[model samples]
Structures are given as C-alpha cells and as structure tokens.
Target: MRPPAPRRTTALLAGLGLLLAGCTTAGDDAGPGESGLLTGPGITETTISLGALTDLTGPYAALSTSIINAQQLAVDEINADGGICGRSLQMVVRDHGYDVQQALGAYTEIAPSVAAMPQLLGSPMLAALLDDLAADQMLTFPQSWDSTLLGRPEIQVPGNTYDVDMINAVDYLLRSSLVAEGDAIGHVFFENEYGENALSGSTFAAEREGLTIVEQRVMPTDQDMSAQVTALREAGVTAVLFSAGPAQTASFVGVAAASGWEVPVIGSTPAYASQLLETAAAPALEGLFVMVSGAPAASSDIPGVRELVESYQSAYPGESIDGGVLSGYGVMEFLAEALRIACDQGDLSRAGIIAAHRTQGLVEGDLGMAMDFSDPNRPPSFDSYLLRPEVGADGGLVEIESASRAPAVDDYTFPTSG
Candidate 1:
C-alpha cells in the first residue's frame, strides 16, 4: 500500500523556508513580497531554474531531440511573455543517452541546483531514482508512462500510462474487428517495467475478449525480430501488440512483411520514429498502428495546437516536427502552471511547489486532453489517439481515431509505487 500524502503544515513550510533561506544568501533579491514566496534552490530573485534529464544520443535520440527543442521553445516564449512570477524560467538540460547509470549521474549533478524537473526520460532510469526523488521532494514529470511509477506525489506522469494505452489499443482492435474472440495475439515487448506494464493491460483485455496472448520478451539491445516473428507466425496470431523502441519496431515490421504475415500491428507511442519512413521498413509500416496521447504536431483544428505548431515552425525553420513537440511543450505548460500557483501562494521552495501542484484541480491546456492534477496518485489522463504511419504526413503519422478512453480503463487497477 502507498503511504499517506505529505501534509503541507505550517511547521513543515517554515522548516523548508528556513533551510532554503540558509542556502541563498541575504544579498539575493527579495521574494515575491505579497505571498511571502520563500525562495529555494532553483528560485532566485530573477530566475527559476528547472532541469531536463533527456536522451539525446541513445535509442530515443530523435524523439528526445524534438522534445527538448519544443521545451526550449516553450521556455523562450515563457521568458518573452515577461517570464513567470516576475522571474525568467531557465531550463538546464543534460543528456543521459538513455543509459540508467548516466541518468543517475546527471540527476545527481543537477538535482542540487534545480527546483523541479519537467522532463526525465526512460522508465528504468526513473525507477532507479524514485527513492531519491521522493526524499528530495523533487516535482518531476517523467517522459516514461509506466503504471508502477504512480502513487508518488512528486512524480507526475504527463499522459496515460503504458498499460492504459495498451488497453485502449486492444479495445480499438476488437472494436474494428481486427481480432476476434479465441484468436491468438502476439505481444512483442521489452523485459522491463514499460513492457510488463503494457503486458498487464493486454492480458486483461485478452481475458475479457476470450483471446490468447503469446508473449515474446526481448531486451533493449535486441534489434533483430526474426525469431520472435517466426514464433508469432507459428502461433497464428491475427494481430500483434508491440511495446518497444523504434529499432525493434522497424525490425519487427520488416521481418513480418518478409514472412508474409499480413496482420494488423499496433504499437505503443515510443515504438515508432519519423526517421523510419525513410527506411526499407517504410512499406511494411503500412500495417502498423500506434496509440499516442497527443494530436499530430501539424494539426490545425485546435487553437492551442495550431499556435504551438506555427510558433515551432517559424522558430525552427528546418527541424523535423513530431508528437514529441507537443509532449515537451505541454509538460512545460503544466510545470509553469504549478510554478505560477506556487508563486501566488508565496512559496517557491521544493515542498511549496509540490503543495501548489496538488491544488491544480483541472488543468486545461493546448494538449489533447484535460488533465486532473488534483489527485497525484491517479494518472493525469487515461485517453489516447490511434494513429497510423504515412509516408508524407506530418510526423509521419495520420490520426485514424481522435482521443478517447476505453471502457476497460474504468476497471483497470493501476499499480502503486513500491
């Protein structure tokens, strides 16, 4: 069972204020006077520093690059608009290269200086640092969406968890008649929290729909999917659910096509990369589908989405755009809201920031869904958009279904942090 939520008592606040006061000298600028905003490590008189622990040189480089760029764009815009709480927002980024060890080292180096982290990528990395993060009371938005990371006040998942997305994927497949009762389904996944969490959903769906799941677990370092595909083909699966990185996606699709296994392939959001459209696997991706939390980056229907896309295109003329841009920008918007609320209460300290975040009842932003941040134990949103790969479409994906939550999600039990 999870522990009780931390109380924001006057004594707790006072202690944190005193501790922070000693950290910043009196020569520093005054706090926001009206609210008695007590300044903390990342908050000075003129700037509020946030940390970004991202993957820039590893398997997720392409997506992480786009995410970081979007975050930078958000920061620039926030600063341009006279900043937040009379102070400019500064994002300090460190590349973890998708390695757990490197991620830990980067967090250690930056945790002392930043008040909060708006972007920390990778499930394994976040799991490794979960205890420390709680101890530090660092409000973090992890790029990973595993259910096991839930029930922690300091860690906020930006969108639906992997299990929730998988449940939705299964629901969509069943509703579309891609798979039927008693049909075998192949589940290709990594041997980690990410894949395991997704597997939980698939298993639940299979039980509900009278289907069988043929599970094939692979490590992140495993790229070739020949063996897995052959096994799935032997199992005579009518549909496939994949929860892995882009490399595995490309390989799995390519091998399936070569083997003449013409089944509908559905993957989690991180499973596809825009660069794959330029590869031999591009043709094979025609049978591929993905479940994501946000709309396409170039979507123009929503006013907020359109504005972000226009600003991004104008600011970065030649850079490629993807759904990561939406995620990066949206997370920053979420963080900025918490900061603004904290500033209003005159408490920029770490504990104060966490306290402020809990008060955000319904956070409506340019993102696809309305997030309820009031309950930190629950996921922010449980909706997903189903998209398919297209050769020339923006972000190499075309939305087949808008954002919607599956009925099964209402019965799904989310895992608590251990």
Candidate 2:
C-alpha cells in the first residue's frame, strides 16, 4: 500500500488547525515558526509519528513492558516540551509476541504511519524486517546489540554489541583477580548469533590474558543446563560467561548451586531480568554479575536517569522500574535527539533523517555513555557497566556497579560476523 501524499496531508493539517507554536496550543509563535520541513509519510505540520515494535506477550514481555512504559514517558515529555520543529511526537505501539512473522505483519501495517521505528524489540524480529526497512529508507533503532547488525545503513544500535560486552566482562574479571593467568574461563551461550558474538569477545580476551576458554552451546529451546554446568565444573573454569536468556541464566546458576559449584558467573545484559528475582532461582542469582551497555536505573548520577526514575515513580506509583525501563528510556532519548537534528537540517523525511544522522558527530545519551551514530557499522559505545545483583529493599535485583572496563576494552574491534 502506498503512503499518503506528504504535501496534501500537511496542507490538510495546517488548514484544519492553527494555534501558538511551541505553546502546547498549536498556532501561537512562542518558539520556532513552522519552517515548512514536514515532508514524510508520518510527518505533518504539527505532528510526527514513531512506531514501537515490541514483544508484549512472549518470553521477553517482562522487559518489553517496562521498555514501552519508558518510551511513552519520553514521548510524553517530548510533546510537553512543545515538540520538535513545532511538531508533537506520537508513538504507535504494537505487540509482536516475539514472533518474526507477526513482527513483519505489524511493521507493514504501521510503516506508513510512522516516520521511523525508534524501537524494534528482538534480534530475530529486526533480522526479518531489515530488507523492508532498507527499501523504505526508514531509520530503525533495534534493541539487539548483535555484531552482525552492523554496517546496515538504516539500522542504528544504541550501545555496545554482545561481543564487546563480553570482552569488557572478561577484562574486568581478569583485572579484578576474579580469575588468574592459568585458570580456564567457561562460556555458556545460546547456539545462535547472539551467543557466537559473545563468544568471539571472550575468546579474544582469553587469548590476550593467556587463559583457556571452554565453551558450552545450547539450543534456544533447551531450558535446563545442568549438563553444561557439570561440564564447566569438571573443566575447572574459574569464571563463567553466560550469553543466554534469563531462564537459561537462571538454569545455569540454579543447577550449579545445586551441584555445590560456586565459581563466579558473569552474564550479558539480557541474562539478568527483573523477573529472575521472583523465580524459584532467586536465591541462586545473588551475587551474580552481569554486563550492561547502559547504566542501571539506580544510578542517579545521570540527570536524565534521575528525572526518568522520579517521573516513573509519580506516574506509575504502583509499578516498579527496572533496567529494561532504563534501556528503553535511553533508546528513545537517542531517537528524540536524532529527530531534532533532522529537523535542524530541514529534512524530516526518511532520507533527510539518515543524512542528519551522518552529520551528527556525537550524541550524549542518558544511558551513561556517549553515542556516535555517524557510522552505521560501528557500535555507539564500547563501554559497559558491570553489575552485581543484590536483593534490594523492594526484593528484586538491584544492579550495583562492580567495575567500568571501557578504558581497557575500548580499542577492541567487534568482529564483523558472528
């Protein structure tokens, strides 16, 4: 289906409404006047629409729900601030159930109404939509940080990839003396691109530190990892790097605890879900370390993070915020910045947005890291936040900082392929 005519739609909106510019009222001239920059399917004289593709009813729902809430919070704030280029932002959200086919269908339906997709939930979903997004010239902000997603012209990753994250994790462990020179490091990861990327990093780091790397691969469908834990235990691995989902992570930890093996376990960001604290494995997760591309929600050092947490508390008093919410907030904040830059460049269209992205040298994100989206292939940040799960006052995983390994891991190039 073809999108509506940009000029006709802009004219219709302008003819139907006129208020104060930037005054929350629409026609008044309190801010920048209408610069006639509305020239896209989802852009109008006073509004710009963004789409959010999420997993609201599948394995990742717990994380995606918080992400959606935080994204809406960002949209609300953008609208309240009189919008960008005198245009209020609107989010068109859809649940994909973490299915590729469903995500493809949902994308087709919402593509015409959105200038860009600021949030696409999973690595698999993004993979399915890559061709369509490229053909349409739509800018995509994918949630996954896979190394293979790099070099795509239309896709933007907000943080370090799993590969770099693992490198940082290994570097931290070695430097902190959690593992010594001759000790073996075990890696348990999904038998897919995500795990492959993570293993690449660990392998590289292991080679550098003269440590042996032992790997255990599992299918995504497999839930129990007692066998793998047994293998690692027998291998005498001093530290374990996990690149699996929350359930798999819990399985590894729980199985290890049951077997009375107490080696240090480190995981990628997705490995630690807030839901884990409620599971039967909650006790086993204590002191588990995970690496995050962004800062924890509890970190009040970043002004944007502090404001987001405070707002979340007031807006959803009954609900609790977590790391997922912070990740979502960071992504949206990056999108908002890109939109503003596009508006400044006088090209809110898809092509214009991509062009503006290249010119954007450095974007300071609320994720506690600065991003550089000028190159599509390169990750925005190589820095990672090392977090240890502790029982917070709320009885959930409170991510406490362990180390910052950016200085050591910064120069390491993420492998091109998984």
Candidate 3:
C-alpha cells in the first residue's frame, strides 16, 4: 500500500528537523581569531596554535587516530604552504585515553594557551567539555556527530548545543520505506551520547512513519554484541536502523547475515566511511546501506581533489585512503579561508573567521561539500548522500553509487565569505 499524502509532509519535516541547523545549544556570534598580521592586543609573536583532543589510547582509537591524522594533515599542509597567515600552525596534541576527566583537563590546559581549541573528537569527551569551551571563548572543530550533544543524552551539556546530526539514515526509511504500525523496527546504539542521539532519531522516525518499534538495544562502547544481535532476531524486526561505528557495524552485519536475520541495514554517516568498513573487513559489510552528510571519497572532478589525494597518500604510505580524509582537507579549507578573510579584513579575530565563513562561502574544491557557518547557522555540514556498501573484485568498497541528485555544493547553502 502507498503512503498517505499527509505522511509525506511529516517525513519532510523529519528530514529538515534532522538536518540540525543550529538545533543544539544557543547560537553564539563566534568572533574571529588572533592574527599575527594584526599588530594589536590578541596578536602574538609565537606560532598560531590549533590544538585537538584525542582518545589515542581508548576503544575509539582507530577512528580517533584517523581524525587526528586528518586534522593534522590540514595543519601540516597549511604550514608547508606558508602556514595560516605568516605564523605557522603549532599543533598541541593531548591524549584523553578514553577518559572524560582527562579530556577535560586537556581542554583546560589548551584553552588558555592556544588561539583555538581541538576541533574536539570522540562522543562523551567532546560533550563533556562543551560548556567549558563556550565559557572560555575557545573556537572548536569537533568531529563527533551525536545530535543529543546539542541537548542532553548521557553527558549532559551545561546548556543546549546545536545538534546538527538530528537526522541520519532513519530519515530515508521513514520517507522511502514501507514501515507500518504493526511492524517493529529494531535498533542498536552505543552507550555514548552521540550513539544515543544517532539511534533515537531512528526511533522517532520509525514512529513518524506509523511503525511500531518493539525492541531497543543499547550497548556500551567496549561490550561484545553477539547477544544484542541474537535478541533483535528473536524480536522479529523487519528492518534495522543503527547507531554503531564501522567495527560494531561490521560485527552486526556479519552476524545478521550469518544468523539468517537478513534484514536490510541502515546507518548514519559514520557507518559509511570506507576506512572503517575496510578496517572491519570489507566483505563483512557488503550490501549494507548508509547515509552521511558528505560526498563519497574525494572525486577527481572536484578542483584540488588530486592534490589532496596525493598529499594524503604521501603522508601515510601504504595506508589505503579513507572517507575521513575529506574532513582532514575541510578543516584546512576553513583555516585557510579564515586566514584569507583575516588578511582582507586587516585582522585575525574569531569573529573574523566566522565572518569569512558566513560571507565568502568557500566551496570545497576537494572535500566535496562546502563548509557553512552562517550568521544563524553553525552546523558546518549538511550535504548528505546515500550509498550501498558492496565489495568489489578487489575486496574493497569498490564502487559507490550516490542515491541523491544534488551536487556537493548544491546540497548545502554556504555562508557568504565576503
């Protein structure tokens, strides 16, 4: 049976609401940074520093390491090519060891010393430091996608943070699939706040589609998942929307397929990363569906795409390129644009960088989607695409097929970089 017309409107709202434009915390006027070119109060003789917090020792190490490499690649590339402004970028790295208090201590240490903060990565850790960063006036470049971080999930934000990831794969199911009231959709989410935010959207989206969700399974970051998979199978779920990373995602897919639980799987952007899937064994994730807010690996058609690819390969020899590389490139794109804007405006201030991003929308020549930080918007990305993760003859996520028609730039509205 066809979905009713009224349900279509609700689905659209769900999609828009999930886009997470300024949905988290209260919107702030993010001022610019201190530029060496400006001979003023904030300007200093030392190198302009951009620090980041890493879970270099914890369960999230693989992705965390990737995030750090990606961010650092941007930093190293910028520094090599005359750096951000005339001042070189000094990376102040800290390891959180998967501990929130450790992460906070690192944040506290970096807050006063650096011009900007670690576009902080990881779920609970980043959310844990949200209020401190806001109160201390540190610019952040976060790598986590947990929408609840905008409000409250597990690690309560001192205040509402903008939840950009309020939408994920579930949006597609509600709008495109045939889920009805009698059918139950099974969901599994990580215990972290980001995982909850990602999974909760699935629940709400399933309900909006007139579907009854019977089983909700939650797992800690380090727990084994054989039981969760078995439980979902017993529950008679017709489909699944998940909040897991590549590793757990792989485990679920492998077990689901082997156990004859053959439901089509759908997940947020994190599930789509090629490196993550590859790390988890490429063949294990074949035939899975994923939705994320960026284009596939850097395409050749995009300007500067080749340079980025070459730079990434050169930096990490023998390591296969992953989807996370685009993010590494984007951070630099923002940093460089901020520098250019600071130069043109004759000052490097936090507000200046915000003005640059808001005014001169820097079209991502390489990373696919342009980063947007508009006057009323702070969720820097919303360009999402859908794909099926099928293994090629080469044993990799060989061929990608985009489920959407919008180009990377057209997918999102960038702030004017005037």
Candidate 4:
C-alpha cells in the first residue's frame, strides 16, 4: 500500500493545493514575508511582490474584489512564513474594469516586475492575451474554463473544463433518464468564440456516451435571454448545458424554471459561483447541477477545507467565499506553488516553475489532486468532478454530492504541443 503522506510533505502539498485552487482561508492571516527581526510566525522577507490583474471594478464585481483580496491574504501568509527562497510576497494588483483594452494596458505595464503574469478571471480578456502571454513566457494559474486554447496556442491552463469537470456531469446525465441513449444533449450557450469550446466539450463527451446534440440555442454573451430560454423549452429538450457567464446563465435557468421546465440545468464552471444560485433564486436554480474542476462539493468536509474557509472568514470578516472565491483561491494557491518550486530550483525562472508544477503530487492538499503542466497536450486538470447545488438551511446554496463524476482522461501521455 502507498505509505501515508509525510507530515511536512502534506503541509507543503496542502499549501500548494490551496494556492493553486485559491483556497484562501480566513485563518491564514500571515502578514508579509518576514524580516530578520520584523517577523511574524509565518512572515519572512520584507517586500517581494508579484502582479495580478482582475475585474475588480467591472461587470463581474460579484467575485473579483473578493478574489483579489483572498489572493493578497495568501501572499501575506507566505510572506509571513519567510516566502519561497527568502523573498517576501507582495501582490501588485491591476484592475481590469472587465474591459480588454484596460487589461492589455495593465498587462503591458506590469510585464517585467514579476516572474510570470497570472491572467485576469475573464474569458474575453484572457483570450485577448493568449499569444502575448505565451510569447512572453508568462505562466498563468487557470481561470477561464475554456479549453479550446489547449491545443491551439500553447498557453497555460490549470483548471479548464473539457479535461477538468463538465464532461463527466454530461456523461452521468446520459446514463440517467435525462437523455435517451441515442438522443443528443441540447445546449444554450453564449454565441461568442469563447463559449464555443464549452459547447464543443459537451458535444465530445456526449458523443463518447452515444448521445447527440439535438437542439443547440446560441445567444449573445450579454443579451437578455427570455427568448432563448423559451426556445429551449419549446424545443422539448430533456436536459441542457449552459456555457455563459453568471448573468445569462441566471436568465436562461431562471426562465426555464419558471416555465415549468423540468430539464436539469447543466453549467460550465464559470457559471457555478455560489452567488449565482442565490441570485438566480430557487425555482430557477434549484437542483441546478454545476460541474467543477477543483474542491469537493462540500469543501468544509475536506481536511484543510474548514481551515481555508475560516482563514478567509477571519481575513475578511463578514465576507463570504461563494463558489467563485474557491476558484480564485485555487488559482492563487497553485501560482504560489509554482513560485515556491521556482525558488527551490535556485532561480525564479518560469521554466523551473513549470517543472515544479509537473513533478509534485497531492502532498495532501485541498484539491486532493496533482497538477502537471509539463505536457502541452493538456494545460488543465486532467480530471474534474461534479458539484450539485442543494438549498441550505438559510435558503442559500450548498454544493451537494449528488454524484462523483470525472472523465477518463487518458491523454496525459500526449506530448505538450501547440
């Protein structure tokens, strides 16, 4: 039998997993990398700084600011602990305003200070910089769940959907009465290039299970979708997969729920933010099934899950970490791990960071999985699980464990190629 993970190794892996999965707990209140005498228990160096660009002031404000704050808290914790190789942790933040031009400007200005640039948490913006980020050797912690870029641009993606979570949810639905064995799964996705890949992944997975796409409704990313939802209901779709952001998802799912449609709402990871369930309301979001790439459905049960949760709570008192915060924390934690490995390898080089990301295993961290970006064929989690939304006591969402789903990711052996 495999030996139990060593304690130190487990702690290390826990740290790595939290950073990668953005599991910034309320209790992780370490200040900055400590100084020789100006040290906190975890504090280490004085002033080491990395950069992050976020949608803090824009349309996605629902989760962006909280995410940045969580990332900052993680950095402060590492710095307090005498950060990687004695360098203090500092996070230089840039607000993207959820706009592409602003993101480009922020990206251009902060390109040189840090070892690598973590991408903003938006699809349109990330897509705008795929080639530029790769060209600059700027590695990123996965944010957008779009996986189409995996084989096309060679950009880094750690928690993407096709290879991460949604496929299995679609597979499970296929085996259920939701869809007839030979029937195709219908989809109502945003009609943008970014949302296309999500729909494609569902199609690929559905086909793998002998299901087809019988009716697909493509709508604009930000349009009012009463018509689209109506159309899907009229199509007589048994089940549907939504590939848009929170707003459109709420619109479609809410309408479907109100119209007495019994279709199980399937969603991309982006639409799985815990806030969405509440904002979308019951009748609309009840029994909504969202597949995710990180953390178990009920994270509070995982070993350090509660710790991270409380850490976030303490750090940002009165703040709540809905589903999106988890993603934010996961990505930040992973980036820290890569940075730690980069320092361990002597120099803070991107190549060294990438190497560390590949060689490391669970080490007993939150995501409870290993991440390997050493190959190009796969840029995201080679596997993922499903998260069902169950109404909690306060009439809020509780990601339920209706099923444990993950795809048979057999392509890890595929070479990392563009």
| Candidate maximizing lDDT | 1
- Residue 413 miss distance in model 2 (angstroms): 3.6
| Error in Å for residue 208 of model 2 | 1.7
Give the candidates in order of lDDT, highest first: 1, 2, 4, 3
Judging by TM-score, tell me the better candidate of 2 and 4.
2
- For residues 188-228, what per-residue lDDT tens digits would candidate 4 score against the true structure? 66666546666566666766677766555554445576776
lDDT tens readout by residue for model 2, 1-418: 0111111111122311122111221111122336644356677777888999999999989888888887888788777777777889899999999999999899989988788887898888887888788878788888788888888767887678898888888877877799989889999998877888889888888887799999899877889988999899899899899998888999989888877887788888877776677777877788454545455545445565666677777766867667777777777776776677667655677766655555555666544656667667688677677666655523144445533554546566756532
Model 2 lDDT, residue 220, Cα: 74
Error of 1 at 127 (Å): 1.3
Q: Give, for candidate 3, the lowest lDDT window spanning 10 residues.
A: 1-10
lDDT for 150 (candidate 3): 34
Q: Residue 100 of candidate 2: its Cα lDDT?
A: 91
Span of ten consecutive residues with least summed lDDT in model 4 = 1-10
49-115, model 3: which lDDT tens digit per residue?
Answer: 6677877787656656666776677777666677655677777889888788999888777666565
Task: Judging by TM-score, tell me the better candidate of 2 and 3.
Answer: 2
Number of clashing pairs per prediction, in order: 1, 8, 29, 40
- Per-residue lDDT of 67 in model 3: 64
> What is the C-alpha RMSD, rounded to one decimal, of candidate 1?
5.9
Please name the candidate that would achieve the greatest TM-score relative to the true structure.
1
- The Cα error of candidate 3 at residue 202, in Å, is 2.1
In the order shown, what is each candidate's alpha-carbon RMSD? 5.9, 8.5, 10.2, 8.1
In order of appearance, the predictions have TM-scores of 0.90, 0.87, 0.74, 0.79
* TM-score (C-alpha) between model 1 and the true structure: 0.90
- Per-model CA lDDT versus the true structure: 0.80, 0.73, 0.52, 0.57
